[model samples]
Target: MAVDKDTVAGIAKLARIKVDDAEQEALTKELSNILGWIDELGELDTEGVQPMTSVVEVQHSLRKDVIKDGDRQDDILKNAPESKQGYFVVPRVVE
Candidate 1:
């Protein structure tokens, strides 16, 4: 993929990056090389390859779902700087 100066400038503008005139040329070449590498990778053939999350298989420990309200209102309110009636008190914002 050939990336021109105008294309690089457009990309920089869209990404909110300020690239100086001299740096823009270098950035355009670097970006083109990176895209070329990606294009080269697309040519490789990989058939029947299973996608893996990790190199080694791992079993995630999961707890059984049990219904409970974990209602420790007083405990939760203890950490609050200002609490009222088992709830954190915040300044009224309604106008």
Candidate 2:
């Protein structure tokens, strides 16, 4: 699970990140430590453990789907500085 400088450099190139020699050396050690920690987790015994999304139980309430058009055109237009029929009026940008 050891990470060398060349591997770090290759990873940096793939990720499109600029990693100098000093940064590559530092990242190599950091990545090696992370891989070592992951290897340590692989040694844990969990034969009968069930996979869980969360530590606590969650229940979602279901509601009936209703589709209706909101007829509040005046209410929405009140926020606009200028509305020509029912649309916002903007200054012409094109010549």
Candidate 3:
């Protein structure tokens, strides 16, 4: 795909970037070079190749799920700077 000056100007407008008339020519050439490289990559053969998330082999260690929290309300409330009616009190913001 060839990137012209008008195409670069359109891209600049869409990205909300201000590109001067002098800079547009340089930018258009740079963008064209990048696209040419991408086109070269598309010509590679990848028959029977498996996609991988990472280069290294890894396994996650997991534990069994269990419910606990066994009644420690008074112990938790002791650390609070301000508590009211078994709950931590925060400063009111809304009127």
lDDT of each: 0.88, 0.90, 0.89
Across 31-80, the per-residue lDDT of candidate 3 in tens digits comes to 99998888886678878888787787878778778866668888999999
Candidate 1: segments with Cα more than 4 A from true spot: 44-95
For all the candidates, what are their Cα RMSDs to the real structure? 8.7, 9.7, 10.9
Error of 2 at 24 (Å): 0.7
Q: Estimate each model's TM-score.
A: 0.45, 0.46, 0.46
> Residue 90 of candidate 2: its Cα lDDT?
91
* Candidate 2, 1-95: lDDT as tens digits: 88899999999999999999899989999999999888886788978998887886778779778867688999999999999899888999788
lDDT of model 3 at position 91 = 96
Q: What tens digits encode model 1's per-residue C-alpha lDDT throughout 1-95?
A: 87999999999999999999999999989999999888886677778877677987788789889977777887888889999877788999787
Ranked candidates (lDDT, high to low):
2, 3, 1
lDDT of 3: 0.89
User: Model 2 segments beyond 4 Å from truth?
Assistant: 13-16, 62-95
Shift of residue 19 alpha carbon in model 2, Å: 1.7
Residue 48 CA error for candidate 3 (Å)? 11
